[model samples]
Target: MLREYLQALLFIFIAEMGDKTQILAMMFATKYKMSQVLLGVLIGSFLNHGVAVLFGSLIGGMIPANVLQIIAGSAFIFFALWSLKEDDDEDEEEGVRKLGPVFTVAAAFFIGELGDKTQLTAITLSVDAAHPFVILLGTVSGMLLTSGVGIIVGSKIGDKIPELFMKFIAYGLFLVFGSMKLYTSLPEHYINIFSVSGFIVFIVICSAFLIKPIIDKKKKGEKSSYQKAAMTLHDYMNQMKSNFDNICLGENKCGHCEGQNCLVGYTKDMIKEGIEQGTITNPIETDSREVWAKKAFDHAKIVDSLKFTLKYLMDNYKDLQKRDMSNAIRNSLEMALFEETLEFHGDINMYLEHIKEKNPFIMEELRKSL
Candidate 1:
């Protein structure tokens, strides 16, 4: 029993490491808790291997060896096809099952383990009669150890592994095993044709799986380009608003403004003070008082600067086709800066603050576009 136990343990554990059920274990780990999935695998294998050992010899005798091989071979071939057809939870993973996560995992593991090579091997190894139950124990331990590894590793690398590709490799193994069994069981003359045809089909299936992700990414790249452009525009506007806030230094000490108050009126006196502070430039100078006033940053000049910013918004948004978005930004600026009247504060910082509040939605829209 000890020798049988070690043999079963070693053989089944090694066989399972590269099996589809191992991949399934990894997949389940991504959706459910690792502990729960491991428990499910253990329970599922215990039940499956126990039953397989109990009926091993009886089933073998009932069906001739050649017929049994063909039956098992054909079953795995169907399994390969079914595995390929089963969709993975990539792109958008679903929430945990309502059917109780442990039970869901256990049921899936049990179902998937049926007619699998490891289970068949368990049946064969158990035919010795005396230590059938012992063989079952060893196999269960082996399966649990292997499945535990799958669950742990899958949890770590699930995001990086392409779900469809993992399924293909798993299914490919099953297809190869199935075809080999079929080839061995069939008469000699039929071997070459069946072997060649199965090999071609498996190659085609694996190639398709490998290429599908690249094609899908290429398609997504076109849409993401638009999103990238939109995000870039949104980010640029935010940066420009930051530049505007820092455009002047005033007595306010915030570096945003040095005005006496946020509500200070735009006047020639204040403009001359700003010029002396280096916040404003003397664009014109003249002997006449009226001509000197023309160079000042006053109420009219403040309103013109605001209008210029609006035009800037529109110009930058020319490609978006959504003038409403730009208009919304403009409206926020009006509400924040000029809500009561064009009576301006000469301070642009408050205007920048308002735009910041309104600018968040553009980023939200950019995310949705992706």
Candidate 2:
């Protein structure tokens, strides 16, 4: 049982390494919290792989072990060929957003895995196994592991890893396993050197034909929606910095300089006002970076404008991404609301309400972090 579980886990893990479902997880991670995305993946994998294992186990019971091996081997070879195919950049038309983040992700993921290679691999692994339940567990574990890595890579690196390279590795693994199974399962007469050589030649030709388009597409420098979306966020950050649009003062464009009209002065005024209002206490770190953030947040609330707060968040988020900070970008915003020494910036609750009305997706992400 242990051997079966580990084999199934490793097989599915490799099968999904660069699969479209992994890509989907990465794309969703860019816009959602890691915990929410991972939870959704867990739920979806459980439901999808459960059914697959059940079906495969029934089929395995009815067929002879050798026949099942042949079928499994053939399916693996087909998966290798399928790995060369490019995924369509389909947009989500389903109304999953109405159900909230967890359900939205679960629904999308379940739908995506209905006929995905990873799901098929789960079924293949279970088709002749002694323990189908263990296979199901292993496959789910594999999905979670791979999807977790995808989320981390997406959040941290911004698609620096090439999708083509991942696909190549997945394809090679599938092909190797499939060829080995066929070699061992074939009749003694069919296991001759000539037969093996001819089989290799056939696979090589098929692989070249299937892989050519993918190679050509990569050479053409095409970008997926996920990559484009990541680039858009980076571009927004760069544009805001270059134009000094996120500065505290609307007309001041010194870009965080120490000039009289710069953010430092704006922060000084906020600290004074907060102290006068009995909202701030002693031991305040005057030179802390978060002090300016606190001021921007508080000022935005006082004036009933999200402009400064939003800009501050965007700027901070860009810096965090660059530095790979694990802390949330809204730490100062939260402090303004809850910390006694910090002046309560604009109603964080009100800001959440506004965000929900204007952009529910961002609102959902915000609520999750908070």
* Per-residue lDDT of model 1, residues 10-49, tens digit only: 6567566535677667655544677888888778888888
- Computed on alpha carbons, the lDDT of every model, listed in order, comes to 0.54, 0.63
Model 2: residues with Cα > 4 Å off, grouped in runs: 224-370
Query: TM-score per candidate, in order?
Result: 0.43, 0.63
Backbone clashes in model 2, listed as residue pairs: 301-346
Looking at model 1, report the run of 10 residues with the lowest lDDT sum.
287-296
Assess candidate 1 and give its lDDT: 0.54
Candidate 1 — which residues are off by over 4 angstroms? 1-37, 52-57, 88-143, 192-195, 198-370
Top lDDT: which candidate number?
2
How many clashing pairs in candidate 2? 1
